[model samples]
Target: MGATVEVEGLTKSFGSQNIWRDVTLTLPPGEITALLGPSGTGKSVFLKTVMGLLNPEEGSVKIDGVDIVSATDRETQELRKRFGVLFQDGALFGSMSIYDNVAFPLHEHTDLSASEIKRKVGEKLELVGLTGTETKLPGEVSGGMRKRVGLARSLVLDPDIILCDEPDSGLDPVRTAYIAQLLVDVNTETDATILVVTHDTNLARTLPDNLGMLFRRELVMFGPREAMLTTDEPAVTQFIHGSPVGPIGMSEEKDATPHHLLGAMDHLKLGDVPPQIQPSEGMGERAGAVRHAERLRTTPDIEELVIRQPDKELERRPVTRPAAYSAPMRGLRQVGSLFALALDVIVNIFRRPFQWRETLEQFWFIASVSILPAALVAVPFGAVIALQLGTLTVQIGAQSFTGAASVLAVIQQASPIVTALAIAGAGGAAICADLGARTIREEIDAMKVLGVSPVQRLVVPRVLATMLVAVLLNGMVSVVGVIGGYVFNVLVQDGTPGAYLASFTALAQIEDLIVGEIKAVIFGFIAGVVAAYRGLNPSAGPKGVGDAVNQSVVITFLLLFFMNFVITTLYLQVIPAKGA
Candidate 1:
């Protein structure tokens, strides 16, 4: 049997835009409830809030006496195991195959053997009628197939509560009916408490045993399916019957026209209420229906029991303008939050159960992909320094100092700065884009729901890998830079090769190389952290991802230049070299 979800006095908003307020509902055990609402009514937001993905401002969501809203991270994680969420658009990791995506939760959260995981995944896939398509990626599949994959993934964990957000979206009528039947079959077999947020009138009219509607920022009614079906409430009737003559207007608000009122009455006079579609005959009685049967045997008339209760009245208040300090305060809070996230990563980076595979992959990507750009920048920078310094030294008749000047600049500044820029520009942007995509797709949330820390699984590995590759790439850039200087001095400037090589190490100290390496490592860490932060907390949608990537690049550049100044100053003061 599934657990009940009780939401009381729940309020949520994004800045000044209130999505819903004082929302109260009870999802009974083993019953399927459909939350119906027009677009922009916050149905999806309500689902996310119930799943603990977004915290309501002033209320509690309790499941089995545990208030998830105020629960600690560990407690909330445990609670999330009982939830199976099918996000709109599937939200599957684009990189993974269908089988791997479905099996991700089990692999991350359980110690099941490979064979067991395979069997369970195969079984769930078969249950969703997605057998033999396990090798396809999410991008390769049709929208309906992706939704089925999402459904299969959600069910693989045998969750107590299944939350589906617009499961029928972007599907044909036949596919929608097939998915509806699949939901019914799953509910019958598992008896999971299912809450589906949808706008499909057909699905809302037929699939769920109970129905609730959200309109004008509040839940209008919630009760047995029969009670809703038999109601003459203007909004509910207009919505369920797909009529345009009642409360819902073109702008999704109550119509204010007397003509609209007359049209609604005329439509009502036609007596055109459609019959509720019954469950298929051969499926036998659903477990949910059986559970309801036991309740009905004692209550006798559950529909009337629900109808007599007053609809929840939400007290509307004037929307208050935000305080003058709200923007600055929000910025400060974000800074603090990012600092804490970085601190968490540092504290847990050395903990046991390392993500070695992900770390290796990141290392390979950074080291290989970033090499050419680093070299390209370093070589030109070194040649320019050599050309200018050689000309100046010759004019002053101190040609021998050309080697020392070029070598020192390449080792102390050019190599580290160039490699850092390359890594931040190339490697850092890649990290940001990847994490941003994952964030937008809700894959990061899925990982959290599966009790996986994205910091450990993704961020730490990338940070460490970038740092490690930065140090190595610095060395490569340094060598190529020195060679570029050598070529410029000996060939282009007509400088003596013997003097160039001889004076190269004359004033260049070992301390310079050490400081350069340190700077490269530090810059790489800063780049990785900034990129991960921007990526993991993107605003929303494709535009958000683009903005995050831009912010990461800009932030990384600022931090790199500022930190370079600080580190360079410290090295110069500490070291006793001639040009440090």
Candidate 2:
């Protein structure tokens, strides 16, 4: 099935800054088109917008005569099914096996039974030349293999159009050639239109039927692959030849050339005519002929392209596993990895167990970093709860209940949530940032190759440390907030400290403290794990590390809040709020 995708005058901006403007292109059916751009040129943003992952401020993208930009949510989803995407990082779910990863879309969108899903997943894996590796995790595979898995996943749905974003990044030349060849083969076999976003000039020039480049947030050129690539145009020549001296400049400097300068970027002329591609009709041709004969019955004009003879079509010089792991080895590796991680965690926990140095460090950070918000919000909040409780106590002529109310509020709700958030921002972001830096420097990769489990060496220690510190921080928050509440009671409500302390102890149950401590431990472990996961998967460079830190805090805060509600609900239902 062929598909034609059109992006008409697409535009998007953030605040006062325009990301891209008036971007227009038409991708013909049954062909591969390349989208090329430098770093930070909004390549990803444009792709996301095309996929309806982001809404453009202006214009529309139509797929096979359907305008996705104007579509409703359901319509957009339906449109998305027509196109499959392979993200740069593979983006496989870390928690699933290879088979399940490839089978995810089918499971979610189809009514296929277990047997059918398994069969289909196995078939796709075989197509990708990854048969017999069903049980492997993505982390266990090389980068090239992961990309194949990603490609397999994308093809499982038999999508009419495929969108690949930076599919050749981080891969060797041989792997890049293989991937390009695979795409060409698939395009021929399925007659599916494909769009690839990339920066590799050779890969781009050699692989696609059409080419386009984004410069200055606009399409610098777009045309037949041969026409665009083998050109004397200064800009196109400079880019295709990988030259630093060109119309483009480093650090945002623009050549004030006239806008209407036609072919300003084209600098070189075509010197040689490449040869044409023709697949061999070998003894194996009998099978293809038989298939072609069969296909002719259903539809005529089934021209068979010999898989091997496509040099001209291939844009010149380009062109171009495993087994069930042994059960014992797998188990031993997993267990040893876990144990080593546990040992490292234990060592880190006891390494500074004087309870003064690291504990004080945590205390100072939690207090200093978090005190501003805590003081601003908690003090006023305490005052409100106190005044409300005090008014009720006075009306009932049982003024001592004000202390009971303050104690319950702080012990049950305020301290745990406040402390978790504080730790999430301070300790969690710090860990995420640090680990992210290590990941960028390839330290984690080095450890992995050296037979060290990153999870044990890195994750276990950080999680254990966080949980240990959180236990103490939760206790401290409770005590400090309670004292602040009593001070608030005395200064604001004129209640005596002795009566306040006495009433607080009388009404506060041990269960409250136990619940608070349990919540802290859970939150701390979750925060640490989340921070480490995000950091370990940090983006390609420095900005990616910052993003990891940012995402870690956000996701940690969300998870902490969610867990708080869940635990609170369970506590109320099962524990009965201490003799309620």
Candidate 3:
């Protein structure tokens, strides 16, 4: 049975900018509701808030009586199991084949056998008219086909509530009509509470059993479809009629427009109410259909509009989740959260059946990217250090000890720092971008919906890989650096090869090499954690992902330098310098 979703007093914002406020509505169980709004009125944000993927500033979203705002992670995950969302672009796993994409939830949440899963996948494919297309990837399909695949995947869960965000976004009119019918047929079959966020007026007018519109950040009207179509509210009339002369101006996307343009946002009217699309022949009526029809007959024509004046009591109600944290505490909070995530990663490292394969894959990838860069940098870096040291030693008439000075500098500092820079610049940036893309696509949300721990599943393996690659690359840099320094000193500085090799052992100890490896490990941990932290919480879109990647590199470099300083200070204090 479809679950009832009750949203009350919902408010959302980003920084100081409010997206919407006081959003209250009820999605009657086993009914199809289409929410109409201008292009940038936070329709997608509303879907995220409803799913608990994004927290609302002040509200309660009770799904089958579980208040999503206050629900624990586990509770939220379980609640999400009852939900299936089709994002604007379908949000299909681009890498996975259509079959695998549809089967992803089953793989995550169920213990079903392979043959059984295959059969179910086939049935869903057939249901969406996509049976033979199973082997094809999402990228290989047409836009309409991809939307159908997303629909099939969403339906596979037999969820109690379904959310489709812009199902007709890129489709032509003919395909859009097919999609509309597909959705109606789906509702008839599953009887799930469904919310469709769209801007298609034809869709808005005909498809939904219930109709609603969001304008100026509030739900302007919501009720029986007839009531909305017949209402004379300027905004409602303007939207349903799909006219340009409405309050939704260029400022529809922005906060303020010129005062002179305010009157330009004038008027439109709702024309004749077209015949509402009904459940198709041979498709049994939805559970809510009879009740909705009964309401139309019994209720007044003015419509029981969901819009309301601000309730003073509800206005004073506490928001379990604030729109934004105070600026002063945000930095401290981020640092604390990073520490907590570090601890979590450390603890998860020892958890049984560790992600050895993923860790190894990441290790190979990071090592491949970092090794050449570290080696190339180490050669010149080592040469520069040895040349400077040899010249200083000659000036002091202590050329014999120049090898010791150069080797110690390279082994104890240059090698690990170079390795850290390589890992962070090349490897860390990629990690941040990958995770940020996943975060923005709601793939992480999908994992959580299937009761998977993203940190444990994704972050842990990637972090371990960074550490392991650091250790490996540290050795590579150390060897290359020492050889580069020795060659540069003996060949370029007019020094004896025997003296240069012998002086290395004259003053350096095993502890110096060990300390360098230690730094590499800690630096790798810092880089990985910082990258993952930012990636997990990117701002909003592709731009957010790019921003996160850049931030990861900057943050990793700063932390590496600071950590290098602390480690160097501690190492010098704990272990005295070796004697010549």
Candidate 4:
């Protein structure tokens, strides 16, 4: 169904800090509207309010005649289902493949079968000119590609209304123009109502059927594009022209001007210049009449092109068309695309291996730098376990078994799990934090634009690297625990080193080492992907990187413990015991 968005007398405030107050606007169906404003002016907040992601303290917003804020939960959900959002940073889950990201809404919202999902995802990727990059993670592609993938994902929902937050923020001039043209073309084709929030005046000026400026907790201006663009109002004019002088003030500067300069500027205006406006010379006389006659010959139809230029000017420049995706057909294309993506991923894994480098650095820091902590833990822990078992042996008149008890407690269970936890605390958090920071800095976005999946490119590599480390760390723990226990055995019970080794060998089995290996493998993947995913979804700007980093470590630790427990339960209960 076609949709229209209408907001009435919206008011929202946090204590004394008002974001927007009594803001009202009507966005007609089948047109692009831009919410333009300076930074911190609440453009994003307004877009969020429209999306029903936020509720105003006082106001009513209706999409297709349904009141979003007052609607039932089901109604609210249905309302959201009608609209698609392209977050400023793409917001593709780092752990998921590009194909999975595009297919997410379909999977979540529909009961479509796997084959159907693949077809739909392929079509959307083709729509965004990303046919073969599906299996690759978001991190491997460039910024532009990531944004396009975000657009493709938004389109997968087949939304009649699209909400884009800062769609053109970091792109270059050419890419920005391409995006603007793409939006217009998409709107023309699909007739979707689009609302874009951006601080870029070029995008704001060239696009949009209607323009609105958020300021001082309210929309100070709202109107048709041409009307707003041609206005000389202080706030609107100053912002549009990139001027520093306006009602906006600086605390350190006093407002003073040369009276003569102001007077001369005022006196030189108006009719003295004999009107600077000029009529189009190319469409004059016979040509104008011919065009007018041709217009009458055909049905009246006018579509707003964001860039208005003469026919002659356009004829001279080569026109670039938006990439189109063919409707999916037979089995071959589906299989082919999947194969291509897999090949791309395999190639990328060996290409740069950035995450591999990071993992190696992380492993080095964890194992080498953390030696003191390991020693501290092992010495006390080994001594305590040995002493406790020795006291119990004396009570039972079996004091010789102290060496065997220490070997069972420290070597079989304690060492592997403890060392794994330590490495997770040290290395896992670092991995997550590092990746998360890169994501916020747009480094991940860079990879997406280059048609590389950050997951395939970054996460897979890191996962592999960490797995190797986990295996190595477990082996190291076995060695350290043995040495630690042997020292305690000799010092306390006058047990020989040979006896300590002999007892450990007698009790330990290959399966125990294998169990530890399985846990490490899972832990490494968990830590790597968690960190990568958190990094890729970081909030806007510099501070968000730091926030993502901090959150990644905390979340990774929790997940490690949770996953370890699940693995342990499966090993103990799900897998048959020796007798079973």
Candidate 5:
């Protein structure tokens, strides 16, 4: 049997912007409930809180007598297995095939064999009417198809409770109706408790056994469908009927004047309320309906169990000036988060079940994909340095010393910095974009729900691979830079080839090479961590991924310069130079 979720006095806020507060509700077991709210009313936030993805400032969410908010990490993970969530965008991993995406939860959370997994996946896909497109990637499918695939994945685990966050979003009415029917069929077959968050009036009116609505940062009402549909409450009527004439206004609140001018001036014609849609003919009675009838038999008046808690009135207050430490506080929080993420990567690195295949893929991309750009930057930089030094030595009648100066500078400074810039611009940007897209699409959240640590599966391998590649790339750049300097000194400046070759090592010691390699490793580690952090914590949409990539590049550059200065200063003071 499915579990009942009980929430009491739930409150959430971001700084001074309170999303919602003092919210209380109970989701009956084995029934479908619909939560209706306008845009920005925090319906999605409520879903996320229930899923334990976001922690609320106050309140408790209990499932099977365990409080999710206060549960230990292990307990929370175990509890999450009982839930199946379909995000608005479908949240499929773009890189995986449809078949693999559906099989992900089973592969991660179950001990089933490959054949068993295939059978279960095939069953769920057929259940969702997606039997044949198994080889297609998410990007190859339409919006409606992706949503169906998400539904299939969610059901693959046979979860006890299902949460659909705007499943009807971005779909036409016909497609929406099809999806609604699918939800009904799934619930009837499995008898799992389902909660759908949407603003579609048709869905709000017909799909659920119970209805709830949020407006102006408050849940105006939550009760059985007949009770809510028959109520004369201004906000509930205006919202469920899709009417513009009541408490709902253009600004998402009631208008001050009784008669206010506005667009879409349609009234809530009570007589026009459509009857609820029923399951298709020949479909047996829903398991939920059977459970509901059983409950009614035990207690004759079920309406008394409906919750209609009164809304708490908040006091109006004058706006106060913003705190001066807000910006610093935000900065400190980001720094702490990044540090914690890096520590997680370290802890998970040595754990059993290593991701060797993913690590190799990352290594190939970081070490090989960046070769051309590294060469391009290194060659030009070497020629420029050689030309300047050659000109200066000619004036001083020390032309042979140009080789020593060029080689030492290239080894001690140019190769490491140039390689870091190439990797940060090329490989680092790619990592950020890849991870950012996954974040915005909800793939990261899906992985977490399936008991997979993105740190272990994605971040650690990339970070280690980048660091290893940076050291190798530094060697390549150093070789190319020295050869470029040799050609520039001998062919263009008429310097003696013998002197150039013999004096190259006069000032460039083995310690200089070691310092450059060390710097490359440090820079690569910083860039990898910064890119991963920015990508994984993206804001919301496509624009958020772009913003994350931009920030990753900028922050990496700043950190590289500062770290280089500190390392160079310490090296000069602690390790004496061999030659002038």
Candidate 6:
């Protein structure tokens, strides 16, 4: 049986643009409910909010008895498994064949064998009329076929809830009708609760057991199909007739000047509400309808608004805008978010099915781009330190001490800082840009809807790679800088060669090198996490991605230097320098 969904007092806004407000609706279990909205009313956003992909400012989305908005990550993820989503345009992976696409959830969640997986995939494909098209890629199929394929994928898990966003978007009238009937067949067979977001008039009139319409940011009306279609509401009348006259807020025009703008809407009655679609042969009576019939006996006169109160009162407080955070509070919130994400990554690292391949790939990429820069920076940096210290020591009649000073500066400060900056500028920026691109493209949301945590699947491996590569790069920088300083002091500054080598070990302890490596690890982790965070939260456009990349680099640099100061201070205090 389908899970009952209760959404109450829901409000969502992005920046200053309010999409919808106080949206309260109940989807009867094992039924089809259509949410109709004009193009920009955030029809799709509502679906995502209910799925917990987007958080509403003031409301609760309770699936069965669990509220997704307040659920823990583990709890939220568990709840998501019960939902199957068919995104508009299919949202299929371009690289995978249809067979693999439908089989993704099975691969992610279940322990089924290859043959059993194949049989299940076949059954779902056959049900959707795509059985022989399994081997074909999504690109090879037409738009209507892609939608059917998406439908098939949604059913593979036999989910208790299904969400369809604009499934009739690009289809012709015949194709749309066929898909509408197909939905009825699916409802009858699976008995899964389904919510579809679309603005197709024909589909609204015929397909769903219940209907709701969104106009000018509010749900004008919602109830059994008959209640919505036979209404005299201007918005409903104008919408059903596809009339341009008397737009949602123009009720005055109907009374003052009704002839031309109003069209034939006044003369034409909606006749009779179309009979609800029935299941095809072999699929029994719709379970939701039987339940709906029984519910109508006591249903509060469907005439007034708020026809059915859900399981409980959703809001304990009056709806209001979420409190705005001041700059300092916002900063604290960001810090807390980053810390939480870091903890999530740490916990996920120990879980099975680790992302070793992705980690290794990122490691190699970071290493390749960083080695030359690390060496280049180290050589110039160490040479300058050596020359400056040599000149000072010679003037003070203590030229032998120049090597010790330069080595300490290079290993204790220069090596790890240089390695970290290189990683941030090269590899960290790349990670940020990659994630920003994915974020803007809705790919990350797609992964979230599919029950794949972007943090676990993508961030964990990348962060580990950054840390590992940072450690290696720090060692390379330390060695290269020491050699560069030695060569510069002996050859350019005309310092004694044996004195330079001996003096390095005199003042520098083993712990100095170990601490530098430790700093590298911390720096790498911070850089990777910062980059990943920025990448995952870029603004909504190409320009936004570019800005996030810049922000990641800037943030990583600030954090790296601050951490460097603290670590250097602590290391000096804890581990005494070698004394003569």
Each candidate's lDDT (Cα)? 0.84, 0.70, 0.84, 0.65, 0.84, 0.83
lDDT tens digits, residue span 505-553, model 6:
7788889989999999999999999999999988879999999999999
Model 4 gets an lDDT of 0.65
**Residue by residue across 213-293, what tens digits does model 2's lDDT show?**
776656666766655655555555566667665665664455433233435433444444242121223312222223323
Off by over 4 Å in 4: 12-17, 55-60, 70-75, 95-100, 110-137, 249-380, 384-487, 490-492, 495-580
Where is model 1 more than 4 Å wrong at Cα? Answer: 252-263, 269-284, 293-315, 321-325, 578-580
In model 5, which runs have C-alpha deviations exceeding 4 angstroms?
Answer: 253-287, 293-304, 309-312, 315-325
| lDDT at residue 37 of model 6 (Cα atoms) | 60
Residue 393 of model 2 has an lDDT of 84
lDDT for model 6 comes to 0.83
At residue 213, candidate 6 shows an lDDT of 78
Model 3: colliding residue pairs: none
- Clash count (model 5, backbone only): 0
* TM values, all candidates: 0.92, 0.56, 0.91, 0.55, 0.91, 0.86
What's model 5's lDDT at 530?
91
Show model 3 residue runs off by greater than 4 Å. Answer: 253-272, 297-302, 305-326, 351-353
Between candidates 4 and 6, name the one with more favorable lDDT.
Answer: 6
192 in model 4: Cα distance from truth in Å? 1.5
Residues 294-334, model 3: lDDT tens digits: 77777665445445434446534544434247786777788
Q: Which digits, one per residue and each the tens of the lDDT, describe model 5 over residues 91-140?
A: 89988999999999998888999999999999988977889999999999
Best by TM-score: 1
* lDDT for each residue of candidate 4 in 340-383, tens digit (9 for 90 to 100): 54355446567653565555655575556344555566666777
